[model samples]
Target: MFENGIVGSLIMIAVGIVVGFFAGFLYRKKIGESKIGSAELEAGRIIERATADSEAKKKELLLEAKEESIRTKNEYEKEFKERRNELQRSEKRLIQKEESLDKKMDSLERKEEQLQRKVDAVEKQKEELAQKIAEQKDILEQLSGLTREQAKDHLLESVKDEIKVETALLIKDMEAKAKLEADKKAIDILSGAIQRCAVDHVTESTVSVVSLPNDEMKGRIIGREGRNIRTLESLTGIDLIIDDTPEAVILSGFDAMRREVARIALEKLIVDGRIHPARIEEMVEKARKEVEVMIREDGEAATFETGVHGLHPELIRLLGKMKFRTSYGQNVLKHSIEVAHLSGLIAGELGADITLAKRAGLLHDIGKSVDHDIEGTHVSIGTALCKKYRESDIIINAVEAHHGDVEPTNIISVIVQVADAISAARPGARRETLESYIKRLHKLEDIADKYKGVEKSFAIQAGRELRVVIIPEEVDDASLTILAREISKNIEEELEYPGQIKVNLIRETRAIEYAK
Candidate 1:
């Protein structure tokens, strides 16, 4: 049993040894797998850490690139803004320069206009001053004894007259020219007067007389105890005398027109059945008005014939009244007509205003109508009438200057004056009294006797000239010139004569030694 037990122990020990070895093998495998799993985990941790570090580096590089692009864009924008600001500044400067240039141009234009106005004002003042100085010089020369040229000559004579022979010769030539000019002027004046006055006059002396049909017509005119006659006289300003003469009644009035009115009124009263005071007055008034109308018509007709119009209405009426008037025993109306014709003829010859001249001549004697009633000269009255009627200045000057009452100022005035003289100087225009004739003769003789060497003097040729006898021993040949000049001056100063007078100073030294 003991032996068996020992063998079992040995077997069991061997089995136990096998089991211990297998278990040892399983522990070694588990320990080795655990170590392998721990190494794999360490490698995964190292890979995850490396991946995280690479992602962080990529994000940083991208952020740096984005920052670089923004910085570059900002630099470009700054450059663009600076260029735009510079361009705007340049545009503003240019605009300011343009405005300044325009303002300067406007100021220059205004200054030029002001300068032109000042120049014009200065020129006008200069003209006015020159005119005033001329007027003052003229007045001073007239008031002083010497003329402007004469005073200048006297001042220059002390320095230049003796040394300047050429000047003396020039003065001599100028004096001769001045004398010739004076002679020519005198001749021209005389020729103009003669040409203007060269005309003929046709005088009409008879008044127009109208005949009635019957003397029995006078009874109707003397209606109801002289009521018609009294009315006619009062209205017509005429006296009616029914006399014993056959078929005749006398109408008398100072005015020739008044008598004609009375005659017509009387005839009308006879023709009408009504012959009372009122009817007579009506007929006379109508006749007077008819005559006045006829007078105006005649004036217009005469003006038409002369080709002169545009006279005032009042002038026409006044011209009509002059038709029936008379002057110097001549029919005033005929004289006016003749004067008008003569004035036109002379105006044509003298180259004057023919129409205006005819008008003046036609109306020159218009004052004769009122000369009997008005207290003034006929010429003065005519001038007033002409001015009041607004006649032209040429015509007004003619009427007053015709009779030498006023000086003539124009060619038309001269023509009218000559025409008036021609009308008045006709063959029977005037009659001279014996007293005036002898007085003129004596005055002519006295003028010749006033000379130094005149022993006897006689007026001949109707006192046109004076013939004087002088002793030749007492008066030399040169004394004849002195005597003639003295007589002519006396005649001009003292004698009032028409045209001109001639003075003849004849001194003869007849030495007759008879050799018989």
Candidate 2:
């Protein structure tokens, strides 16, 4: 029984130990399950947080993109609005320009129609004048005993004689009046300028003649069979005239520049002592280039000297042409310089714009260089050129009115006119033909001789006066009135006297019956 009880106790203990072990294992499994649950919950929280952060970041990114898109859209809308406004403004301006153009066209058309009507009116007036002249002739024929033709001739001749004297006096009076005012002021300005600025006149020649060393040099220049001379003449448009004048050769050409080219080339060839056809041609071409350089340089120098900037290059080149031009036996460039100086002085004295006046005066006669080829007078040509070069209106008007092409509108215009006259009227400036002078005197005398009842006509006072002696038998005191009228009318139609001519009609009668 004891052995049985021991075995049973051991069984119970083993069973109990197994039970405890199972309990402990069960407890451990529960705790581990709880810890696992807690860890799983924590893991879920971490995943949720990471998901929330991702969502937040995505939302932020989406908002930022949306904002950027809005900003870009705003910028595009603003740009589009600005462009629309600009387009609208441009369209409005274009409409306004079109309207202005249309108005201008209408005005021009209206002016043209008015001018046409005026022209027609003027034509009708001219016809009316002709008819009146015919009616007057018929009436005068009926009054006079002579035929219409004869009366017309006699009346014209008599009127011419009377008009000669009265016209002279009238001219003198007008001149005196002009001298008292306009001329006096002009003289004061011009004299003050001229007195202050003293300039020397220079003589210029058209031909550029070169002197050779000797007659022997001519043969070398001519080369064998005159080849050198031919080459030179062909290359340079100047004619090389090898005359009997020892050591003197004349270079003749219409172009002053070409003549200068020939002169300079010939001089170089002479100095080099190598005279041949090839050498002549090469030298001529070289000289041409050199002369062109000189021309451009001269233009640049003149612009620099004058202190007048912003001249067109073409205008400067044209100014260079004046370097070789001459007028009335005076160097044109020198004359221009003198005029500029004088004008400046006048401007100083008169409180006018000196620089502007001097510039205009210097360039006033620039057209004369090319006037030979141009159709208009020098003043007109120059004015047109100034207009072409876009010169000031004042300068253009001054140039035009220098020779009375248009009326003087400014003080500079008057200054230019006076200066031109002064330069032209200077001693040895111009030469007149003897035939013209003699014809003028005869014309002056013949004007008074055609009067009726005039016994004799004498042109006295250096052909200034027409003294007519009328016989008392032929011409009575009352008839002198008609004679004077006839003579005066004729002078107006035929003569172009500057000042005047006096017509004196002397009528005297004497009777001596007892002595006879």
Candidate 3:
């Protein structure tokens, strides 16, 4: 029985334990329900607060949008009003500009009318002036007892005469001044050159004379049958004149060189006393060689004296030939040397090329050396020779133009020309025939006598000065210079003279009254 009771007590303890477990579970469940209800209420309250906040936020956004719309509309209205006011101002300015344009157009119209009226008035005045000019022309034509054309011609002729007189006076005054200056300068230059370079005048004759030691030498020179003389003449191209002149033999030939050769050969044969044909030929050859040597020596001497260098050998030989040549009784070589010296001096004075001037002057007469053989003027031959010799154009021109055959191309040419003239115009430098001298004087007088108011004319001073007598009544003082110049011009055009001619005009009025 005790065992049973123990069992029953254990069982009761188990049951109580179980019941306590269940009560704990039920209390836990109830607590979980209450917490759940509290969580639900908190969640609902959070949701309602969220909904009310969202509504307030939406109302604030709506109010801001309405304020933005109102501000935008007011701004647009203000902009519209400002733009409308600007358009109104612009329209007013355009109206004012239109009005100003209209006023300017009216002013322009008025000015145009004024200009037209002035133009009409000017046209009317021109017509009246034309009529008045016609009337004046008619009245003048009637008063002058001449037609319009005749009166015009008469007036033109009167004006022409007046202008001619005035022009003559001007030319006279200008020529006087120019002559004064030119004369002073020319005289100074020419005189200085002449004084510095004075050359002795020499007249060369074309005749050759050989004097024998005795009268017996003439027959020996004649030889047997004139064989010796014949051989000499044939070889030397000279004439042996055995005249009545005692102890002298004359060699006549146009060529001075041949004459010289003949003279030397004859002299040698005489000295050697070998007068045979063979001996004569030998002596002639020797004389010819000797003459050639002399020619070379002369050429070298001329070059050395004048300081001219670098001449071709042939040219030097030609220059030497000029030593034996003569023109117008003047030695060509000596004339050439004088011309060179004068040209050098004048070129120095005139500031030209002295060396070139001297060279041209020296060679100016080179053509005369061969002029006997050549068929042309000295100038043409000289130019041709210079060109063949490879001379410069300036040298050729100077040679050609020295005689005024051509216009001088350089100052050196002019200097050479003047120097040549001075050399040739020196006293006793050249000679002319009596016939030519008389003819030149007559020409001078004739030229002067042809002019009106020239009563008489006289050529004095070797045809250098022409004295003209003018009628005092016909040629006035104003016209005297004109008349003199006219006569001088005529002389220059018609005459070919060396140096310069002086034109002298003499006007004298003689009134003789005899009272009883």
Candidate 4:
């Protein structure tokens, strides 16, 4: 039995050894298979990566080639444009040269024609001279009585006499015709200009009237021995005239602006019921500022109404100063506006520059705005103002020449002058005292009477017309026209009158044979 047990144990040991060996071999085979599967997956992934890289590199190369092609195309296009421009410039230069050559050729042809005509005329004159000499010699020979020199002298004397007579008659006819045409045309143009332009005239007084609330307010205004009134006058530079004119006070001053300031200040004081000097001063200052604003506003309004723009700020303010200014009791601002309208109308009718005419007309009297403060005539001052404001040369000339102080250089300047005259000389445009009017009429008559061959002179139609009766023996019928023109010219040069004056010369020969 023991021998059998040992043999079985040995068998068992051997069986265990075999199973262990087989398990070890299967484990080794499974590990080897797993490593092979991982190697295959890594190889597939590497191949995919390499294919994607190759496709990306090919696309990058194609994009680079497209960009290079675009750059080359742009360069070629730019070069083509430059070349085309150069060609065009060359073509233009060649065309201009051709035109110049053509013009020169035409000029040469005209000169040649002129020279040929002159040469032909000289030859014809020589032929006529030779023929005349031959005929004179034959006549001298046939007559055998008079010398050639004597005959020539007789012919010259007769020709001279005929020429003198013919010249006198021609001059007379020309003068008559020219005078008739000029007078008719002038009348037509002036009448048309006057008929087209019409504006209202405004009269301004130096004194301003301010209405008070009651009579008692006057005492407050006077303020304890006129302290308040004196304070106002001193500040505003105007005289306060307090009279028994029923709750109204008169403000008088040569400076219209000052008078206006006083009027405003006084009205404000009365309204506030504060009559002390301190309150008066405050009110005056406020009133002055208000007047300044009003002046600027008036200037702007004038420009707007006249359609004139681009005036300097200083020029506009100066124009406002004319609002309170007066010329022979005519409101200067109104007069300026009327002149502007008249100038524009006349310019339109005459086909002149309307804008320039209106601008000059509006500013023509701007010098009057500062004439009282300045030491020169309004024309000179206005010319200076126009220069300071950089106005055009034409405008400066018009302003300076409107009063005939300077000769007008442009048609617009003439239009401005005519408009100023028309505006100032129109009926009711200005007012004068009875004394001045009488003196002006007497001066007009006196001017006419100063001329020779004047029997009597009468200033008729408010000094707008002058009638002179000349002695027929002293002035002939033809001389009447000359005498009238001379008198008219003398009046224009010597006198200062509104509108144009007519000088009429009447020469009537009276042969009174008394019936027996």
Tens-digit lDDT string for candidate 3 (1-516): 999999999999999999999999999999999999999999999999999999999999999999999999999999999999999999999999999999999999999999999999999999999999999999998898899989889989999989878978998899889999999999999888766654212213546778888999888888898998898888889888899998999888778788789989988887898797889889989999999988888877887787778877777777888998877666889998889899889988988888888888888888888888999998898889888998788889999988878899898888888888787865553556789999999999999998889899999999889999899998877788888888889999999998999999999989999999
Q: What value does the lDDT take at residue 341 in candidate 1? A: 88
- 168-265 per-residue lDDT for model 1 (tens digits): 45555675799899999999998887666532121122222335568666687687788777887888777777777677666766677887788787
lDDT of each: 0.79, 0.79, 0.87, 0.87
What are the TM-scores, per candidate, against the unseen true structure?
0.44, 0.45, 0.46, 0.45
lDDT-superior candidate, 1 or 4? 4
Residue 86 in model 2: shift from native, Å? 99
The lDDT, on a scale of 0 to 1, for candidate 3 is 0.87
Off by over 4 Å in 3: 1-204, 426-516
Model 4: per-residue lDDT, tens digit, 325-437? 98866789999999999999999999998888889999999999999989999989999999999999999999988877788989999899878888797555355778999
Backbone clashes, each candidate: 0, 17, 0, 0
Reference-based lDDT, residue 392, model 2:
93
**Comparing 2 and 4 by lDDT, which wins?**
4
How far out, in Å, is residue 269 in model 1?
Answer: 0.7
Better of 1 and 3 by lDDT: 3
lDDT of predicted model 2:
0.79
- Pairs that collide, model 4: none
